[model samples]
Target chain A: MHRKLIESFGIRVRQCREKRGWSQERLAEYSGLDRSYVGEIERGRVIASIVTVQKLAQALNIDLADLLTNCGPPSGPGRSN
Target chain B: MHRKLIESFGIRVRQCREKRGWSQERLAEYSGLDRSYVGEIERGRVIASIVTVQKLAQALNIDLADLLTNCGPPSGPGRSN
Candidate 1:
């Protein structure tokens, strides 16, 4: 809900973007979303659906678990893939 | 989409339930979800929404980032919290 949280989400996406050397445009193309919408997501202007997040994770060749984990600490026990 | 993935999500929820020392009934009371629904989630009988995940994280006193991280690996470079 906080701007910072959205930014944090954006930062996570950005990390993936950088990892794949994809611009927002490229990520949109690869992920089958609108380029501007991706920008909004990266800018913390939107709350993405779980499906979209899953698509982003897959397009980035990343796991949703890792993406979520990268942003914060676990509240309880860890899981194994 | 895979059964394993659904089960993984269930496991994540169960970990949080255990962390809070709450049974399905108590967790449902605290999280505003049905008890049987909670059981299904834990048993990998369902895929929860992000809103549900958010509630689970809050009830467990954990960050969403931590919960997600506990589940899997980052396909690309990881981000710092």
Candidate 2:
């Protein structure tokens, strides 16, 4: 479940960034994160800290709740709100 | 801004736990995290990783978005969804 959630989150991040026409490097610059780290996050190879997530949200100009809730299709019944 | 956000997150966690009549130790147990760590999170002395936040959300029986959004009174105008 955790792995699935992380993967979904990565996909969400990628979609959001792409929606803004921002490159991984551009997002890294805006979020004060490493480009490679952002790539890894988008690939679901890494899980970010809450601070990092907040930075990404701020850079994307989205609310934190929106980032988490609208990441993908609704999660499974037992796993979601 | 980061500090304030963390503090608000902590307060939200505390309120959620209390509403369930669960002790810090119990929340820690359910989340598979350490009691002291939970305390630190509640005190806003630590910033948790996304995975940890998810664990806390699951333990609290709340959605991740709700945990992040409903933690405190609405954030300032510049903040919040």
Candidate 3:
């Protein structure tokens, strides 16, 4: 489940960056993150910190909710909610 | 901005746990986190990892978007979005 959430976040980050025609390097520049780190994030190789997530959202100029769509646990049966 | 984001997340976590009538120890047990760590997170003294955030959301039985409400930068005139 954690892996899925991380991958979903990475995919969302990649999608948002691609939508703006920004390369990984460009995103790193905008987010003040390392280019390698951005690549790792997009590849789901690292569990990003909340601060890093916020930086990516700001750099993509998107809402945090928008970036986190479908990144939560599925609303299925047997759930406590 | 990073400090603000972390603080906002911490506040949300505390609010959700309180709404459920759960103690920090209970929340920690549910999230498989340390009680002291949960306390620090609620106090905005630590920047939680993405995995930790997901665990908290799941344990709270809330959507990640809901947990992150109002966590993004405000849509002000100077914003790029």
Winner on DockQ between 2 and 3 is: 3
Q: List the residue pairs that clash in candidate 1.
A: A62-B75, A69-B69, A73-B66, A74-B66
Clashing residue pairs in candidate 3 are: none
Q: Which rank order by TM-score, best down to worst?
A: 2, 3, 1
- The collision pairs in model 2 are none
For candidate 3, write residues A1-81 as lDDT tens digits. 899988888997888777666789888988899999999988999999988988877776666666778333222332111
Kindly provide the TM-score of model 3 when superposed on the true structure, using C-alpha atoms: 0.84
State the lDDT of candidate 2 residue by residue for A5-62, as single tens digits. 7888888889888877689998898889999999999999998777888888877877
The most accurate candidate by TM-score is 2
TM-score of each model, paired residue for residue:
0.58, 0.84, 0.84
| lDDT of each residue in A1-81, candidate 1, tens digit only | 445555776788877687555688888887788999899888878866555677677667666756644633221232211
RMSD of 3: 12.1
How well does candidate 2 score on lDDT at residue A57?
A: 80
The reply for model 3, stretches above 4 Å from the true place, is A70-81, B70-81
lDDT of each: 0.66, 0.79, 0.78
- Each candidate's clash count: 4, 0, 0
**Candidate 1 per-residue lDDT over residues B1-81, each given as its tens digit:** 646666876887787666555677877877678899889988988766556676666555566655554632221232211
Per-prediction TM-score, chain A only? 0.76, 0.84, 0.82
User: Which run of 10 residues does model 1 chain B get worst, by summed lDDT?
Assistant: B72-81
Alpha-carbon deviation at B43 in model 2, angstroms: 0.6
